[model samples]
Target: MFLDILLYIFIGIIVLQFIYYIGIFSVFSFKKAEKKNPNHVPVSVIVCAKNEAENVTRLIPELLNQNYPDFEIILIDDASSDETLEIFEEFEKQHSKIRLVKVENNEAFWGNKKYALTLGIKTAKKPYLLFTDADCFIPSNQWIAEMTAHFTEKKTIVLGYGKYKKIKGSLLNKLIRYETLLTAIQYFSWAKKGKPYMGVGRNLAYNQSEFYKVNGFIDHMSIRSGDDDLFINQAATKNNTEICYSLESFTISEPKTTFNSWYRQKRRHVSTASHYKFFDKAQLALFYACNISFFILAIVLLVTQHQWILVTALIAFRYLFTWISVGCGAGKLHEKDVVYWYPFLEVTLIFTQFSVFIHNKFSKPVHWK
Candidate 1:
């Protein structure tokens, strides 16, 4: 009878996961972004850099080559001790479209990227602002066009994909990308469900009005890591947000090659989740907790051989439905290779995230770099 109780719990979790898969996530898997805004509005492409000279060097030229019309590049040198400021000045000289915003290290907001970004956002000449990191590059010149196409009168926020490069023979690369794909599916799908929460800075776009309306990240300026997600979590609304997944709209960056490096990056990201709106935070926690519980209960029920056949069928059914749902999402996001490795990656990530949560309880991550 005790095993029956556990079995019921497992079934309930499966039902919850299915609700997420079918109700919230299914829209993004099959829906295509109608990137149809025909006008190429004047745009300001903003990037913040701190000791990222080499990456910024490659990025500036790639940004210079974007095919969008009537656009200018604003590169903010965030108190870099390196030659990043000099590089920005050089590009400013060579190109008339490049503008530079230099932010000195503020003792009050030391090492905070948001301080530098606020300066850059204020300096932007265009009302439409697009953001990316120093290391990111566009797959095509049509990136700005594709992203801005989603910016209609009501849709002031445009969320785009930022994918890590896939390296063969590196399991870390696959794991990082799989996680990225999974996150994208949830955020994009949630936006489709009319409860927009967050967006990646690497390919995010928004109108400057939204920034000034929210007082421009002043609310969470103390936190160095949430310039993108936190701002969207507070500013994005169902009627104001839009999703753009056109191939040209995606930004690409290199994945962290080492597990330690990736872990540190993840810690900074995870620290921001606590500040998310109540509903967003609660739903995310519920989803992750149910995922972990599903595997735990399934293993115990089967190993004990209590109603083994029923448990086996339930497990098979759950995995089959998950594969179909996630496989569709992976194909849409250009990560179909991750589909076969889904179960393994999902289990590992659940535990890895649990470790990160515990670690964050003891320590905090600082600095944008």
Candidate 2:
């Protein structure tokens, strides 16, 4: 009787978890950008580069050609040994809107990228600040307009999606893209519900004043990373944050080519999880616990007793519902192809991410870009 009761309890938890994934996560379906004047606000787009001459030559021009008026592009050269400085200087000569801040890396400097970003933000000329990476490609010229359109008087922080470019015929590529989509659904859904916890630096914006008000990474100076999400985690509130889901607002960047490279990248990202607020950490923990438990419970029940039919039915219901919800989200994010890999990748990520989380705690600390 005790075993039977335990099985039912586990089954009940699984059902609730499935409901949350579908019912709560499906909030993305209703996500729409609130109408506002895209051109009204003057934005300073900041890109901090170390040694990305090739990418700068190819992608920076595209950013300069953006359709928005009354905006400046602040490119920070963080002591590059390559041709990055030359490229920035050339662009500066060609366009007056482009401002280059050259930094010579010194051993005496206190922080890493956070220090560099602080310098960039300090030099920004506009009230509103937008940030992206050197490798990021803006899909449309209206990227600024779409991202800024969501900003209002109360909404100081604007969160936008940054996706990895699709690589053909690669399983790793598919999993990477699906993993990004899954992470997006969680962050985006929470933001829509007014519990904005984080934002990606690759495509994010906020008011320059608010950043200084929070002291701008002063709290996390000793720790590396968090230049993006950690700052957002600290500054964002229910009333002060908004999200942008329009395809026009999206930014795409190159994905790491090897498994080791990708793993290190994800490790660096997960390292910031330890510094998140207690509530945010708890929220993420519950989701991961339920995900891991679902699989473990299913296997134990199958082994202890022969309830194959019932177990199969339960699994089928959970899987089908989750697929529908994820499929809708994928379509909304312009990641329609990710839905096909959802079933396999979802289960794989449950284990893979657990391993990464554990390894991150004990492994050598990851540094800033």
Candidate 3:
């Protein structure tokens, strides 16, 4: 009877998560009607480069060529040990609006990226700021214009989608794509509902004043990451946060080739998850717990041969829920191909995330590129 009660409770939690996913899908579908303006607020595009000489040389040009009326590109060379600064200097010599800043020394208690961004933000001439990594390529010339359109609606922070460029004949490529799609769905859904908890730094924008208002990375200076999501979480109010899903505003980055590299990157990201607010933490914990619970329930049912009907029903409902929710999100992000890999992705995600949770709890600090 106790096991039955626990099973029912787990089933109920899964059902609730399923309902939450469906509700998000409905909201996203309804939000599809909102159109963006071509002429919007001016923006300052910020890129932080660390040992990315090749990326700075190749991708920085595309950012400078964005079809926006008024904008500046500020590149912060975060003590890079490569030709990253040299590349930026070459670009600066050619482009008038492109400025370069170098952080040679660690100032007391600031993380590398956050310190660089703080310098960039202070140097920015515009009120609006759009941030993307040096390794990412803007998909369209109108990227800045499309992204800035959201600010006209009084939004202080706008989170845009960052996807991986498609690479064939690689499992790591598919896994990275799947991870990107999954994150886009959750973050975009939450943003659309005016309940955003985090934003990816790779392609995100916010007001210059808002960053200062929240004291800007002062809270998480010791932690390596959170330059993007944590800042957004602190500054994002219901009236001031918006999400952009337009293809013109999208940015693409290269994927990690090896499993070890990917795992380390994800672990670094997950390390910051604990620093979020109570409600945000609860929501994420609940989501992960549901996934873990469903997996365990499946195993228990197979072993005990008990509550078979309830287990089957819950499993069916869970799959259907994930399909629609993740599918709708993928559709909005222009990643419909991810739907085909959802089943495999789901299983891997549950296992990997659990491992990440355990590893993060016990592992020492590790750096990544």
Candidate 4:
């Protein structure tokens, strides 16, 4: 009787997984990249740095090479202890399109990203704004063009894929890359369905007016981090949000080199999820709960030999759908290499996230930079 009950739960979880893969995730996997923007408008590209001198040095030259005709680069030095400010000043003097915004540490909002970003947004002179990290690599000059293609008069928020650099001979790199890929898949899929919730700051763009509409992150500015997602969670509606995942639009960032650093980063990111809308939290929780439980339940039933054939069938069926949906998404985002390791990487990541949730209850991440 006990084994049968377990089998039933396993079956139920597998069904939910099937629904997510077929119904929700497939929206992004089967979709095509958007066309070019004929009506490209003036844009202010914002990059905020705390102490990323070396990274920004490499980044500035690439930002200047963007093919977009009308755009300015707004480099915000958020109270850097290093030479980040000096580098920004030099770039500003060299290029006519480069601008600078220096932000000192606020006593009430110390080390807060939203505070620094708010100052940068207010300083922008353009109608449209594009944001990225100082450490990110821009491979294509058409990144601004591709990202802005979806921005019609009504569609103001544009979300793009911010991928991590692929490091060969490193399992940790594969895991991190897969996690990033999966995140893009979920957010892009949600935006495609017209229920956009959150976006990453690494490759997100929007209208400056929309920032003013939500009062520019004042609701959650007390808490550090969430300059990108929390703002989108508050500002992005079904009608105004648009998603872009073209290869040309991707901004690649270096991944955490060690497990300890990666854990801290993941914990910080997961902590922000608690502040998301109630429905967003619930649905995400459901998907992860089902995903994690599927593996656990499948293993238990197979070991106890409770309807082993039926349990095996359910596991196989769920993974088949997973491969198709996740595989297509990886392909679309040019992450086909990570798709093969999804079976292993996904199980590890889900359990790792569960561990992160348990650990975060005792300690929370307080710093954004």
Residue-level lDDT of model 3, residues 1-369, one tens digit each, is 967876877678787776668876457733564687675677889999889988888888798778788998998988889999888888899989998898886767334678778888999998899999988988799889878888855777888888899887776787789888877777777777778888888889998989889788898867778898888778887789888888888899999988888888889888888998898898888877877777887787757867777678777888887787777777777788867888887788778888888998898547434
lDDT of 1 by residue, 281-357 (tens): 99999999999999999989989998999999998888888888888989888899988888899998899999999
lDDT of 3 at 182: 78
**How many pairs of residues in model 2 come into backbone collision?**
0
What does candidate 4 score in Cα RMSD to the true structure? 1.0
How many times do residue backbones clash in model 4? 0
TM-score of each prediction: 0.98, 0.95, 0.95, 0.98
lDDT: the better of candidates 1 and 2: 1
Error of 2 at 334 (Å): 0.8
- Output the worst ten-in-a-row residue range by lDDT, candidate 2: 29-38
Candidate ranking (lDDT, best to worst): 1, 4, 2, 3
Give the alpha-carbon lDDT of every model: 0.91, 0.85, 0.82, 0.90
User: Worst 10-residue stretch by lDDT in candidate 4?
Assistant: 31-40
- The whole-model C-alpha lDDT of candidate 4 against the native structure comes to 0.90
The lowest-lDDT stretch of 10 consecutive residues in candidate 3 is 24-33
Task: Show model 2 residue runs off by greater than 4 Å.
Answer: 30-37, 108-111
lDDT of 2 by residue, 193-295 (tens): 7778889999999999779888999998877788888998899998989888788889999998888888888888888888998989988998888888888
RMSD of 3: 1.8
Candidate 3 regions with alpha-carbon error over 4 angstroms: 29-33, 107-111
